[model samples]
Target chain A: MSLSIFLITLAFIILLQAAIPFLLKRSIAFGVTIPEQHMKERALSSYKRFYSATILITGTLALTVYLLWAKNRTLSEDQVVFAGLAIQFGVLFLSMIMYLYFHVKTTKLKRTHKWGAGLKQVRIADLASHAKDEMLPSYMFALPALITAGLLVYTASQYSQLPAMIPTHWDIAGQPDAFSRKTPFSTISLLLILLVIQGMMFGINVMTKRSGIKLTSAKKKASQIQQLAFRKYSSWFLFLTTVLITILFGFIQLVIIQGGMGNAAFMAAMPLGFLLIMLIVTAIYAFRVGQGGSRIKVTVEDEEAMETAFVDDDQYWKAGIFYVNKNDPSIFVEKRFGVGWSINFGNPIGYIFLLVSILLIVLISFFS
Target chain B: MLIQIETSSDIPIYTQLSNQLIELIARGQLKGGDVLPSVRSLASDLGVNMHTVNKSYHELESKGIIRIVPKSGAVINPSIRDGISDEHRLRIVEELKPIIAEAIVLGMTAKEIQHLASSILSDMKEE
Candidate 1:
């Protein structure tokens, strides 16, 4: 089971890397903005093909080598896990390098060709979109917190019957590898961490609601519909993931509280199931909705009027990845190269958010 | 309602924003009591400086087209039926004076100007 999981994870990573080009907004290719008319250029298609083929070939070769090592049984289970991680990171690094290569090549090509020179450059905002009842209500997230609280109460009531030492670490086989003296803190720590994570999830939902909707001028009405749909579906995805994570953590807490009495395979399967569900759901969401709802289908009546070029602000995007615009007050903007939003590094609020998240992770780790 | 900003336009960003918003209001697309997006929200949505959107909101408020409530947001004011005040009428004439002069210099007839104004008015009411 572990071997299969490792192989499946590696395959997923490689495919996802190759699929990155497809997942980006149609206006953006390899982190560079392309005019609608230039998107179908032969050179661009060849570049995309070369990038994907290179990543696939290199990643598959590495995975095959790892498979051979794993099958030889010369390496321990821990080494097998580490080797799988190394391979995944190796592929990821290769893909990043290739992406930058294409980004530079595309930028150079666009510069020489003047892809959108003649078109009017414009940005659009929909005032009424904010008023739309699109987001999942904040109160809905409170359900998971309520469940955690219930578990906390149960833990308190059963404190006397709990083991003196509780498992704090588990191995691949679900055997307890480390333990800490049972105290009220250790007993309820996981529940507390779960609560904090759930709160963060709630915060993310609120941020999504307030994040600016960037409409593509190439298809104003269609882009508007797509943005709304993107916001709606992404928020729902977040809420559902929050619920699933809360349940997974709750199960772990229950097992720890009960002195690790659950079956070994079941215990191991819980987290694996959580990861599998999350990956599958995210892949499906990205495929269906796309970055900024670029994949969503919509029709507009006056296509000619909306044919303005998407404003070329490539200067703001450093390497087609990090967005650093001092003049742009937006805290979050849709990423140019990938799915979902990225922080505007020029905004001080982005740094504050990053620091707070790091602090939360530290707190969770310290307590655990 | 959608408000578009042309970065390369000769008009400043804030003026463009205020102009488009006023046009929306004049067309009744943004009705009385409708709350405009907050400065930060609109600025971020248009990817411009917050001061730009703030300037536009203040311009609208100065023109009495909207009232900015500190907490809630900028709300469109109900249209008043009373004819323009003398000062306001004079200000309108001062603003239109240059455009009318230019039209005349460009060989546009007075009747053609009247027809243009009426056509624009009808176009607004059409929607």
Candidate 2:
């Protein structure tokens, strides 16, 4: 594949990864109660997304530059390759800046008396206040994503001006430019546009999380239906991104190989493999999303019951105490300590190990 | 030291820490004036928030089981004073009355329960 083509492909993949989290965040934000801990989790996930994108864009750009220098005898002196690299690096650098900014802001918010005090108070109003502050970091985080999308669209526009093929009318060199031409913009724009949409989705999520009012009895059923629809939408979003990338890459490879080498056989095998992988991943993700959504529903129900009881007893002062009632079987005894309380679902040591593994993957990809 | 926290258990973490430490002290496993791990260190090691550990330390301090200096860390109390007044003894009995009643209902004779209590005390002394 040409260096330009490879860079465009990788950019799309990174964009897909970026978009997935935004969609997931939106679904979660809209469907569940926005606890302080959930906000922290969202921030952490955004960091992961930023880290992944940095690794991907850096690795692809480096490889593309090397390939252009070594393999492309005709386009070796082309400034387009260098310009593309500069744009990619600019995006990567901006992403890092945004990541750092969000990280610092979140850490400050976490340590500050106001955020900590509100969480401790655990009132509906207090949580809403914290959620509002949480949105500030997200807005800061989205800046880099926006910048990358703009640069990508510009790069794609420039690339479109290049002739369909250098030597032939339909073929670029000996390779057909079918896939590149079929998509008017480079794949990079496809990915970035998706990312921009993802950003808007995350905004919706933040709104849902921050809204403090309970769903009225009439709205409860509708809300449940909405939650289910959102969950399905998120699942399909991830599935479609995976499928689209797989098909686009496969098509590009086929176009590069030019129509003679058993195209039908390769085409048949590729989509089957893609579908298998997509199904497996989508199943796991869907299950997790469903489980998390149900848990949120139960929590919301409990909160409603507690609110009603508190009002009846006129125990306004005790309402924010956040005590686990003695009769509540669902309250975990150890989680009351308030630390490592967010690390749930199994042994703490194992959970920490998984988190470390994810961080190591990001670091490895970043430096490689 | 290994600390296990079962979130689903009825006992709160701080109470669990207190009871476990008290049991350890009663059995002479933790010596007087021995330094306990700093709150932050222990909290991170145990994958908990520092506030949780701080609450446990405060409880221990109030019971004179440990002394927490602002920056110097926690230390086991040097003296185990036997300062239970008569009123305090009555208060202790008052707390135990419900448990004793439950035990009686569970089919233990007075002599048997007394004998069992003595044996447990002897076991503690041996440890």
- Highest DockQ against the true fold, candidate: 1
- The residue pairs in collision within model 2 are A332-B7, A333-B7, A334-B7, A339-B49
lDDT of 1 by residue, A1-368 (tens): 56778888888889878877877676788888888888888888888899989999998899898888799877777788888888888998999999999898999899899889888779889897677738798888888899999999999999999998978778877777888888898888888878878887776676667778877787777777888888889888989899998989898888887775777888888888887998899888888988888888777654565555677778899988999988777777786776776888888776676578668767866876
Q: Model 2, stretches more than 4 Å misplaced?
A: A1-74, A77-368, B79-91, B115-127
| Model 1 CAPRI rating | high
Instruction: Write model 2 residue lDDT over A1-368, tens digit each, in one string.
Output: 23545455446544533333343332122112223333455555665566556656665666566556546555543454565566556655655464456445544544453332332211111111222222233354344455445545554555545445321112323332343333433334334334544444344333332222212122233334333443344434443543355344435333323434435445545544555565455544443443223322333332232221100101211221132232111111111111101122222433454455556545533332
| Every model's DockQ | 0.83, 0.02
Please give the distance, in angstroms, between residue B43's alpha carbon in candidate 1 and its true position after superposition: 1.8
Model 2 chain A scores worst on lDDT over the 10 consecutive residues at: A308-317
DockQ for the candidate 2 complex? Answer: 0.02
Measured with C-alpha atoms, the lDDT of residue A172 in candidate 1 is: 77
